[model samples]
Target: MALSDDTMRGVNLGGWLVLERYIKPSLFTVPECFDKGLHDPDVCTNDVDDAYPQDQWTLTGLFKNKDDARKYLKDHWANFVKEDDIIRIKNAGLGYVRIPVGHWIMGDISPDEPYVDGEWGDFVRVVKLCRKHGIQVWVDLHTAPGSQNGFDNSGRTLPTPTGVGWSGNPENVDRTIKAVRDIAEGIKQEGIEDVVTGFGVLNEPFKGQNEAQVKDFDDRAYRAVREVLGEGTTVYIADMFDAERFNGFWDDEEHGNTVLDSHYYHVFAQTPRGFSPRQHIAYVCEKNSRDVNACCWKGGGAGGGTSVGLKRMIGEWSVSFDTLVCTKLDDVMDSYREGGEVLEFTRKIGEKRKKFLRNFAEAQMVAWESQDTGVSVGWFYWNFKMEGGAFAEWDYLRGVEEGWMPTLKAEEKAEHVFGRCEEIIFRTDDEMDIVHEFPPSDSVAPDWQAVEADDDVVVSHGESLLTKGSRERGDGIVLGFLSLVVFLLLGLGIAKKCCVRYFGGAGGKGGYQRVGEVGGVGEVA
Candidate 1:
């Protein structure tokens, strides 16, 4: 089933279930800080000698041993996100929350670091709480076994940061599929299927692998997820930065209802590097719109399979910039210091900063809500909150409160934008093929050709007639070879007849032998 237009606006429950150093550095207890007599004030921050021992700053590195980490999670995981947070989400007018979780929560990665007895139970509570608040939940398996992304957010990092992830090992892929099955069934058993939208099988599975490996893993993992969830359950497959691979993967008849998830982050890539604050805003809005049109709303051609059942959603996006603007804003205006008092420059930049951020944020919302691109299910802001001296641009609620993010009133405009385009899949739940107005060109037509209802034989121009299962185009080489062979044989027969007629047929040998024998009689008789 397609997600309702009203329920698309969303935010991610980051830094709560998942422990990211960039999100909440205080959560990790470093020995260097202790030596300096500094301590994190939050009691929830686990105390340990070296949580990120060996430079592995992930949730798995939170404690010295598995037991300590499990005990800490058991005691404090619930507090990280509570009923109040759900209420906050509800009040923000956002209808969905994409919760990023690790495989460890379901006990996929164990013996090394295990979740305590009731650790998995905490997830159940979160879903129930969201349901209670009339909010939908998107369960994203962010960290797969062996670390799919090899990034800290996936809860593990490699010695060398090559993005070689779970795809490198077959067993890791199987374990992740098993974990996905367990989560899908667990949610259904708890009767949260209505509230829990779908399981994001593997988040960013093959970030840097070749396309073949990515598709191979995607096919296996998707089939595994569909088997567990059954038909009609919306399964989200991350494009792994390969959107083209997902072009028509889920459009097949047998595949269940699925949504392609693409994360649109403006800060990371090099294209938007030198844009002004306003240009950055315009670029993202335009890019976001173009991506949606290409993927879902606009059909390439009739030969292009109908994209009717296809749906796409931006699973993650942020309003932050990687430009000098963000650098200037970081560290409490430390970058703005030249001659004037630092505090004065900080205040001056802060005021101007709000306007830049507000415009940037609104441009994204408008582009996302624009008639052409608004076809997306909805956009999920990168995060609900971040604890480090994190910039406010990354925080959804902070941006909203400071007039940077659009208010609920402005966000409601997306619901009406649907009318501008023809009715999309969201309006109907029927499982029918969606046809584009412009039929696909002949070159791209599906393998099967269409025939008139009354015609007994299907006639194709310069193509042979085909039976129920026959090849569409017949072989011309064999026919041409037979014609050539027959013509050559006839010419040879004619030549033989002519030679016999010209030399007096059977008597030709007697007539020519006497003349030659007279001259050579002396040599031979």
Candidate 2:
């Protein structure tokens, strides 16, 4: 079945099926591997150290054989996000869960590949458990055949921060598509297709460097999955950090039931790190709001001609303000100092960090759910929960426990949060100006009097018959009528001049007119 029209408030099941060292540090710590100094021949064949297995590929090397690797991974998968976690998710009022899976979950890993086996069964078990709890699933192929982004989360940690190889290698791209198809087929065979209503073809594929290849893979992978899952399923294509570039990618008729998945994180960039807590909330309420509205489908036209854009979802986002938390908080504090704030001022506000984080989270929720700004579908937090419950900002369960994330149950509660923020940041016109550096054109309130006047009947001669009877009107009706006539005459004159200039006139060649010319009727060509 297709995803419900209701906003998809969900959380990502990160570090479960696909391993990320940062998410679950304990899983990567293998004292035996460090002590024995043994590496997996397939992945750790390089000069790199095997002691620190940054990704799933290298982590498998720590085990003696496939059986050992399977046992270890199976244990982690079974316990990481068990039935209780699913129950907790449902109780938290979230309707969907995005489970990130490695490409090897399809059991197509070659002998040369260091990834373990039997994750497919564990993945199915998680989906079935979610089904029982009345929750939808977004199966995300987080890792591709050859690390799509060369990031550790892609299940392969490269020796260096090199560019992606998945798009460059045709076989890798094909394998990735096969993996997508396998996932769809598995869901079908397991009879969990109803709950597994969404499928993310790839997570965070670097589109900027491999636009053509990525587009081709998206088309092929989309078709491959659809061939098995049919049209009811929602196929997600990652925006790859460039949302504007792929704004209307899935709007066409051929791409029905497709969603552009975009991940939004403010902490990664320098500009956001410099923002004050209030500025961060304002940025979401204003700048991010405008961008979301621009990217989302406005619902008028058919196929690629849709009025605004494609169906979009904030596939991942979090309340985290800083990029990373090192052992010493002081090391990162200076880097994230607010713009123009002295060290003393930064430290003062640091005391009330929890309150600011709560406000920021609420602002995001309000903006993501706002019809005026949010994505057409909805949003999912970056993660359901991190390993140790240390990263509260990225962990939904921790955020709720700490009172930073709202225990959102209904739409009414969302509105209340919005109202509360409005009272603090967007309450007054001036306050609104503070939030929006460049206010949207539509932000200005319309002139009701002028709007009502527009409804008056106007003759071809530029005379208006006052619709509001003159008997009931004041003596100033003559002045109003005269003013309207004068305005119409000037407008007509300007239109005629614009026509003459464009179609050739005394001006010769009708080159162009500046804004200063013809009473500012035309722009410079």
* Model 2 alpha-carbon drift over 4 Å, by segment: 35-50, 159-163, 296-309, 323-351, 373-375, 410-416, 420-525
Candidate that scores best on lDDT: 2
Runs off by more than 4 Å, candidate 1: 5-7, 30-59, 62-64, 110-118, 159-163, 270-273, 297-306, 323-349, 373-375, 409-411, 415-525
Global lDDT of model 2 = 0.63
TM-scores for candidates 1 onward, in order: 0.67, 0.71
lDDT of 1 by residue, 436-513 (tens): 111122222321112111111101100111111122224356544543453354345332223222222222111111
Clashes of each: 4, 0
RMSD of 1: 24.6
lDDT value, candidate 1, whole model = 0.53
How would you encode candidate 2's per-residue C-alpha lDDT over 459-492 as one tens digit per residue?
1111122212222345466746744553464445
Q: How does residue 377 of candidate 2 score in lDDT?
A: 80
